[model samples]
Target: MTDRAGHRKAAVWGAGGWVVGVLGVLVALPLAARDRLPDRLATHWDASGGPDSSMPFWAATFVPALIWVAMAAAVVLVQWRARKSAGGAAPGWVGATLGFGGATLLGAQASIVRANLDHTDWREAGSVTVWVVVTLAAAVAVGAAALWAGHRARVTVPPVAGPTMEIPEGQRFVWLSRTSNPWLHVTAAVTGVVAVGASAASVGGLTGAEAVLLAGPLALATVVVLCCASVQARVSEKGLDVTFGPLGWPARRWAAEDIASARVETRTAAQVGGWGYRLNGLGTTVMLRGGECLVIRTVKGKDFAVSVDDAERGAALLNSLIGQRSRG
Candidate 1:
């Protein structure tokens, strides 16, 4: 088989092996300690690090496994569709998701088991705060590793020569394009609603520690709603200008002289490390969706890209401007 086919096979097997391994570990941990565990396990903890929910021993073991299975299936389906459409190896996000999700589930399961071990009653389980923090850190590290591996595994495609526009002397040109992810918009709306609710709760009666918990989520939600919902790209004689959100106060600008080259390239969320405003091996990318991106190489040898419609024209205009600036 060709190298491409081999890579695809490896990706499939790798994902399958990861899924099975995680599932096995999730099931085995609880069963191994069944004798030492209570009839029910402390499965949920509240803000105070106290057990506020319990699940039957068997339920706790199988429920997480089931959730893992469902998530694996969804990831597999998405990768399959992407492979079929792109006719390339699995996207990097697939590995990242599997790594992150599997590690997170395994960590949470281990924490539950450890907390409930030797306890006659589920309510007597100890706080999982330390374990939770450790788990989060481990999961993030594994996810980053997996993403790097995927990037290394990717088959590099040769960059194609992009179309360039001819500019007449004394003529003016400007290009503008906007891109938005509906999913991100929905996410922002949901987070905005939560922030509003939390603000109301804080004002209504919440005080002290209770209000502090609300404050964290409220601030996080507001930031997400403001910064990650949408993006707009504009190219003019001045250079490339990118703005975030509806108000567009926060923006990035590249002056014409600072741009080394401008071109149109196709990029996917998986290629640039998933979702909005990503930094990875490919440099910084404002990825709203997978399609044509206006990519620029700065004079400082850094790369920047933004997913946008009619990227070809935008890139052409930017190139024209750069050429004119260099000649002058």
Candidate 2:
């Protein structure tokens, strides 16, 4: 789409999504729950797939609706302002996504509320598994949408200079390593232990099936931490490389000629949301945790950085390789 058209279309979608989502929570939900809202509504859930907390009907409905309204307004306003930036930026894709997804989520929750409003036995009214499924799906959808849109907004494609940065069949090799924080290990260990204890405590609140379903992702997250706790970085005249231990997943290499610059940078979670693999204006960043990073800017202005020890040496070596190759 043309810039003007894309801007208009995105704005319209943002506004409409916010409006529909808010309206669904305010009007559609109330109508659906009509006479069913009990003296007190089920507002919170416990481990056993039962309602453990209650709220007055007005507070239960209005409080959430107010939050949605605020979020929706903020999203639309931010997006509109971001589009006006020099590079035609989109509002923080994160916010746009939340605007879009938050509404959908709140609406979904409203539906669940209406569905599960059986005061006679609120615990038995709705499927806890269903709530989990809807929420996960909504969150994933929002993230996916934001990433796609953000990529379009932030990255300007670089000009290809005819197969740049090709190594002559392993003619040269260089390697280095970067160790992560021991504190990260401690955090992961604590999380795993806490998760284990929580799961055990809450197992009685759910059926055997519910427990298994919920355990799936938590188990996967723990496994990921175990596998990717440390990052090993390597740089060669050929390019740059990084790999994770244990699983050794996502082994990556970049060509030296493609690099515009390599610089030492310190990044924060607020800059790229959270750690792990993050994307922002600079491009893909494989951040293990927040701290010093070696950022490589591509010829196209795209970038990829990683937080690791000895970032200065890595950036210097990588830059020297690029300089030497260009001089050759």
Please tell me which predicted candidate would have the highest TM-score against the true structure: 1
Instruction: Give the lowest summed-lDDT range of ten residues in model 2.
Output: 198-207
Full-model lDDT for every candidate: 0.75, 0.58
- Clashing pairs for predicted structure model 1, backbone only: none
Question: Best candidate, lDDT-wise?
Answer: 1
Worst 10 residues of 1 by lDDT: 199-208
Whole-structure CA lDDT of model 2: 0.58
lDDT of 1 by residue, 125-211 (tens): 988898789879978987987787567456342222335477777776667666656566556545544443343333322223675
RMSD of each: 14.3, 15.9
Distance from true position, residue 45, model 2, in Å? Answer: 44
